[model samples]
Target: MSTTEQAVLFSCAQETQVGILSLPAEQAQVGVVIAVGGPQYRAGSHRQFVLLARRLATAGYAVLRFDYRGMGDSSGSARDFLDASPDIAAAINTLHEHAPEIRSTVIWGLCDAASAALLYLQDTKDTRVTGLCLLNPWVRSETSLARTQVKHYYIQRVMQRTFWTKLLSGQVAWGALKGLARNIRLSKAASPSRGAGDLPFQQRMANAWTDFDGRILLLLSGNDYTAKEFLEYADADTAWSKALKQARLERHDLANADHTFSNRLAQTTVENLTLDWLATTSNAIK
Candidate 1:
């Protein structure tokens, strides 16, 4: 474990200040901007990210981990998840401003946050983003949802959607399973929204990644349900294979880890692997 600095507040978009843990070194050569998962924001919940940031900082890299807008101590609505791209972009801009000497900037994200980063980079034209470190990134398409857990969790999601849809439909009646079933059916039958969901971002990201002149390290956990889903999709999609082949992206699989690396040993392994990759890539570039 390395020395870690205390948390600080940084202003992002429109007077919204996010809670950030800044780990700085006297001769930092690079800076990493990290975003945690959606449901996680408490300092305790992000101990792994904090530990990694401190360790990386000790290794001559400045690291910034901030709570996304509307989560944790940040000033914003929870709905910010719907448009978190700006949050990431704002964090990147703030990092560069705070540390102008940082020659390289890498964005690291887990799960949905990783998906947000992909979309953010695609939409923002002048960002200084140099590379990406995605951990079990969410890249599921409509078809991919079919393979998802259709039990309690899915049923709950269906019920929530039903409640909202019925409220909007002016139907005052509500039956738990019945309403949920109706909503699921409606959702399945509804036409897909154009220019929305993960497709546009996936297409743009796949294209950008293929032509990107920078390096990308994709880390996947063998036991991660999301990773399994992605693998299924990848195995079925030739475009994904072609894109990865053309991009020359690097992939690493942690055979014994879960999506969050809940196990201490697994988390440590992930941290070490990430640090090693950073050091190797940094030296190679130099």
Candidate 2:
């Protein structure tokens, strides 16, 4: 299928949001709205979003990659993904308006953006979102971060023979030991029960995830700490796990990929996986 890209500016709660809508010659009933995370804009880290939008559009699905309030060319004070529901909603609305052929939308996001997408869909109870494609979702907390560092970073390094070799050779960084000690303390004091569902932002996502009766795809980057942290939390608690059980859910891991899937091969893998998932899990597609 052929696709064309259009720049879209839409209003959301008095702020002007900017987005690029990639429309196929014949659009699928289900479109994808990508949420940008952190300081990254609509182009994504290494233009991942731009390339992804074009690829998905080429596969016959409409895709919208946008910048929230303050980021990119959008106007307003700078805001993080935690407070981005309005932006997400606005993007979805744009898709529906510009592409009337689109009957449902999927929120595709990575890192904190994934967290924001879940929070938005749950808090707004927006009926238009029929699916979620979450990649390495951000489920960080002081405790979780501490515990992850202690377990995955510190413990693993300590057990390594090279660590002992460096220690004996006086090449070890003592400052790291101090940091490890602090993280260990936090880990011990931190409880797995004190995860996302307990905080307002994650709470919204948790509520929505628990009650969301839609299709979901959980993508994991095996080499990322953030991805490991999410798994640790899920293994310790039932909040996200139980909800996932009730939904039409699938999970995949790119064992050699980084957080942003920066490598071209990794990016292409994600592109293909997403298109395949959208095709099979589409609620609006017969």
Candidate 3:
């Protein structure tokens, strides 16, 4: 069957409107909503997301690729990570309303967006989602630490510090050293911790997956930095890996693919594998 492609806008929430590219097939059994990665608004329009959406649509699945609020053509402010969950929920709701006949709804997310979708599923308990496709999800505990490293490496020298006792004691040199020490301590404190907020983003994501009744597909790349990060944070005995194995989720690791599947052959391989997986899983569910 031929695929019909269209550009449309749908409200993600009460006042938020998202830009979407829809691929409609003649006889689609499921609908997929894609969530692209990047915490910043500018990165949402990366070529990988668009290419994957079109490829899946052409392969007979109805696909909707949209920008999260505040990114691309979507309505919202920039730097709104906390709001990503609601944005995804809104997109899923919109898909269901737009394609009521499609019984299965699959959510495809990459990097941080994948984590956001998991959080949404956990909070809403929306059972309409029949499958989840994660592309190099970013679920690492050291995300905060990495951010701190960047700041320290690039901008630490420019910051100024105040010495509290220097004004009182008139010991200028000692006070200066004390001020420097205090600044160091403050920076250390501000650095991301390994607590709940510091927990690997993926482990937090596992909470939702543990309860999901649908199928899951994890696509990893041996050369991808995110995959390397996963190895660093994931324990050998962790529940996340165990659950994935037990669930029999299709796991594919492209030896040469980068995080974004920048290589043309790698990207094509991913496309083909994903389409095949969807076809097989869809048939089994039917």
Q: Could you give the candidate ranking by lDDT, starting with the highest?
A: 2, 1, 3
Q: What lDDT does candidate 3 reach at residue 39? A: 57
Ranking by TM-score: 2, 1, 3
The models' CA-based lDDT, in order, is 0.68, 0.86, 0.67
Single out the weakest 10-residue window by summed lDDT for candidate 2: 190-199
Off by over 4 Å in 1: 1-6, 42-46, 80-82, 148-199
Model number with the top TM-score:
2
> RMSD, each candidate, Å?
7.8, 2.3, 8.6
User: What are the models' TM-scores?
Assistant: 0.76, 0.92, 0.75
Q: Which stretches of candidate 2 lie over 4 Å from their true place?
A: 168-170, 190-200
Best by lDDT: 2
Clashing pairs in 1: none
Better of 2 and 3 by lDDT: 2
* Model 1 lDDT per residue over 110-163, tens place: 887777777677677444666778888776665544444343245556578666
State residue 11's C-alpha deviation in candidate 1, in Å. 2.8
